[model samples]
Structures are given as structure tokens and as C-alpha cells.
Target: MALTGETSTQLALRDPDIRLMLRVRDDDAEAFAELVELYHHRLVTVMHHLVGNAEEAEDLAQEVFLRVYRGRKKYHPKAKFSTWLYTIANNLALNILRTRQRKPTIPLNVRDSGPLGPRPAEQLVLDRHAQPEDRIQQQELAAVVKQALETLNERQRIAVVLNKFEDMNYAEIAEVMGLTTKAVKSLLSRARDNLRVVLQDYIHMNEPGQERKDEG
Candidate 1:
């Protein structure tokens, strides 16, 4: 059966796990397992982007789920399930990045590859075919962007991940991160400025005669 939005919402509303989660507040092992199955892959994907290593990302994702399972009794519906899930993910990723002694090695232009999904290069080519120089510049630009993201303060990085990648608005981001809307805006502003500076040369080189636009 295809998982359409309506069907997914209905499943969520009627999901034994969600209902189990309500029971989890009272301590239910079965419900916890259900939540695990539902969120594990998503959590792993988020962690991989933040932590930059599949093995570590998987470990971190497991830890997040473990925390949720252990803290089930304390679960509250102050936000959507996804927001709460991502909040835990964001915190864990930041902590991992903080405690590590070695800085993460930012990868250059590595395209996404999946068994069932279109390859990253294929997707890019389909969107826009470019000359060899353009391709090189694009890869360099992506590398700079990734490096710049690594340099953001933990909170700022989380904000950008949510805002840009997750397409969350300020209110949603604030709710997920437990910050005020104004604070979320400020964090994103600082992150954008930093990225602009870090990627200035790439932007200028790519745009040719155009002045670089301010990052929103």
C-alpha cells in the first residue's frame, strides 16, 4: 500500500505505538519498540548529516532512541512527535561534535548514493547540465559550504539544519529547540553571515559579475 499523507496521518493517529506512547507515560515496553521501529531510520539520517559518519551516526541515533525509551514516562505532547524526535537528535549531534577532540573532515562534493534512489550526480545533471569548470566550481562550493557548516556554533548549526534542510519555520524551530522565536532568528542570522563569509569567493566566482546576495 502506498503511504500517502492522509494515510500516514491516519496511521499516526491510530498507531498502536502512539497510543502505546501514551501508555509509555505509564511504562509500556511494547509501545517503546513500536516507536523505535517508526523513528530509527529517520533519526539515523539526521545524525549522518550532523555527525558526518555512518557508524557514529547509527550509534548516536540508537542513543537518542534509548533516551526516548527510558524517558517514556516523561514524554509530553508539547510539540508534534517529529519535532520532539528531532530535538533529541539535534542535542545528541551537537554533544557528539562538542566532545570530539578531532575536528570533522568535511567531504568535498560527495554525491548521495542509494540503492533505490537516484544518485546525487544524476540528480544534479538532470537539474542542470554544466561545463567541466562549472562542475569543479560546484564541487568546491559544496565543500566550502560543508566546512562552513561545521564551523557554526552548535545551536546555530542546529537552527540552520532545521530551517534550511528540514524547511522548518522560525516558530517550529523555536519549539523544537526550546528557544524563543527571536532567538532562533538571531541564530540563523549569525549562521548565514558566517556562511556568506566562508563561501564568498565561491559565490563570487560562480556568479561572475553579480554581487553576492545576502544570505537570508
Candidate 2:
């Protein structure tokens, strides 16, 4: 007999950190810190990749934990603890992105701190192998790839970040994004298309020609 998706998810909720969250719901302050310790780096990593700003991601990660603690009493183990933690993270990332959309601000960390995706800076580097003169600086390459990622809409960007950085599958991405798995599929499909379009020129490693020509 196959376990349904919901049942599988419910069963997965029995992981250690979910129990820790359950303890948090019972006023266990130590359990809460333990949860923070467990997820802080991972949360920061995902948020940083999502937003393209390391400092802001760190601040948002703290807020996510703080919000989780404040909502502890209402916490329920309906999903994996990581999933719930990332939900808080996802919301914060979205809000920050929205705020950034309204007012442009300089990003704190733009160096190799962008999307870790199926499409990544390293892949771009690989594509440049045939053109030794076209190799871009690592930072420049990351920034270019990041720019391509920014071409995606918010939903697609988030989906790509989770799928690539967090190693989450369609089901988990769907759970975090509050969408159906089918919707996640469509989002990824579209995101890849947009990335290919935005990155078409750079995909051939020809972008460095401009910088080299400038120096010449």
C-alpha cells in the first residue's frame, strides 16, 4: 500500500526538530534556541541566495526565528520543522523584495552570493572553457548570473532558490510556496525559459568581450 502525500508529510513531521518545535509550543525556551542553532545557517544561506543580499538575509533570518518564537503557542506539527521555518523565511524574503521593488537600495553582498541554481555561475564558467579570452572574473560572472535570475518574477525566483539551494523537490517547494505541485512545475519551467532568454548572450561567454574591449 502506498502512503499518500499527506500521510507521508505527517509522518515526516515526527523528525527531531518538529518535536523541538512541539516543545517550544510548551514554553521550552531551550528547545527554541536549539531550533535556531539547527537552522540559522541554512536559513541565512537560502535567504541570502533568494534576496541577493547577505546582510539583509541575516537580519531577515533573525526575524524569522523571532516571529516563530512569538507564534510558538499556535504552532502545530502539520509539516516538517524545516518547512515551517522556511515558510517564515519565505514570507520575510518576499516582504523585503517587495520593499526593494518600491525603493531601490544598494545590496550589501553582491559577490558570489546570488542564486545557487540549476543554472549557476560555475556552469557559466564551464561554458567559457572554449574561449580562454572570454573568461570573466568570478565576481563578475556571479553578478551576471544573478542579474539573469532577477529577470524572473518573485514566485519563480523563490521556486528556483528553494529547488536549487535547499535541494527541495517539487512537493516541498509546493508546501513552502502554498501552491500545488503542478504549479511548481509550471513555475520552474517558465523560470528556466526566462533565464535562458536573459542569459542568452552570456551563455556563449561573449559577455567578457565588452570588458576586455574596454580595457583595450
Candidate 3:
């Protein structure tokens, strides 16, 4: 449904990022810079997950910002600012994925700051007092999880990324992906199922009930 003008204004008032976006629409360079600073790392991280290459992710992230700046004059708050921003990122990431003939390989040494926070695989990271061997095990498990994420199809991966990393609900993810809320739910469900199968072996390595705590 199209948002009524009054509802749009209410959303804008409620979200500080929307207000910053409003400032950007007015050609406020500082506001644009602030928005870039706020989201640059996050966007790059997400793009890295999507494209599976640091260089391509960085370039794609910069392009997303550039598109934002170029289209600033047309900005309007139809939804949360992050939603609009991610919509752009999603479109770009999909384009990149579609153009590739083969799927990219995920690195074994995946970064600690991955999406889905500390699920079963991440839980392998014990306390600060953990021994070096344990830390190494944790890193290995995390990489396996990352590789599992890469196994998902593009749409499923995008849905999982937005839901887990961006903390978006089904409705928000649907808006970004141009799917119905039900479709987003289905996508995440399948993604969870796939991950569960791929990561089953590692789940036992974590403490009890660690896998059950997964959100989205």
C-alpha cells in the first residue's frame, strides 16, 4: 500500500536517519557525509558478503553511495531510510550476482564481524580465557558457517543477509527485495533449513541449545 502523506511524515519524524536523509535531499553536504560515514562500513560488509570479494564489495559500496548522492534531489521518505538505502544495495548486488557465470568462493578466514551474529558456529569462540587452540577452532567453525551462507541461492542469501545482518523484519525485507512479506518469510525459512543442514556437524561443538537461539 502506498503510504499516506501524513504517515510518511510521522515515519520521518520517528527515524533520525530519515531526518538526515531529508537534509541530504536539501543538498546538505555534511548530512551526506554523515550518512556515508554511518553506513559505509556496514554497506561494504554487506556487499562483501553478497559479492564474496573485498575489492568488488568496496567498489559496489562506493557506487551505492555515489548513486545516493546523484539521486539526492529526488529523495523522499516512503519508508525507513535504511530500507531505501538497502533497496539500492540489493538491486546492485543482484545485478552483480546475475552477471557472474559461476558462484564465488567464500574465504576460509571469515571475519569475526559476520552477519547472523554469534549463532551455533560463532558460539565456538569461547571466553577470553580460551586457549589458542580453542580460538583456532572457533575461527574454523565460523568459516564453515560463512561457506554455508554462500551456498544459498541469491534471493535466499539476500533475504538472510537483510534479515540477520540488517536486523530487518519480514515486512522490511519484502519492501527491499520487492517481494511480499510471506515470500520473505519463506525465503528465510528455506535459508535457515539449508544452514541447519550445512552446519549440523558444528552445532554439537557449541554449548547446549546454541542453535535454538538463532533469530530470523
> What TM-scores do the predictions have?
0.64, 0.75, 0.76
Candidate 2 lDDT over 22-124, as tens digits, reads 8898899999999889889988988887788889888889999999999998876677778888887888788888888787565434553445433343455
Q: Give the lowest summed-lDDT range of ten residues in model 3.
A: 120-129
lDDT string, candidate 3, 1-216, tens digits: 224565767977888888998899998999999999999999998998887779999999999998998888888787778888998999999888877725434333454435644543345333323543355365565666676786788899999988788888898889889999998888999999988876665666676654334545
Model 1's alpha-carbon lDDT is: 0.67
Among these predictions, the greatest lDDT belongs to 3
Ranking by TM-score: 3, 2, 1
Candidate 1: worst-modelled 10 consecutive residues by lDDT: 119-128
Off by over 4 Å in 2: 1-13, 107-135, 204-216
Q: What is the C-alpha lDDT of each candidate?
A: 0.67, 0.77, 0.78
Ranking by lDDT: 3, 2, 1
lDDT of 1 by residue, 1-216 (tens): 122355434655754555656766677777677778887877786676676678988999899888877777677554456676787787777677777625534433434333554433334434333443455544555554565676677788778877876778998888778889999999999989977765554554656454345434
Error of model 1, residue 60, in angstroms: 0.5
Write the number of the candidate with greater lDDT, choosing between 1 and 2: 2
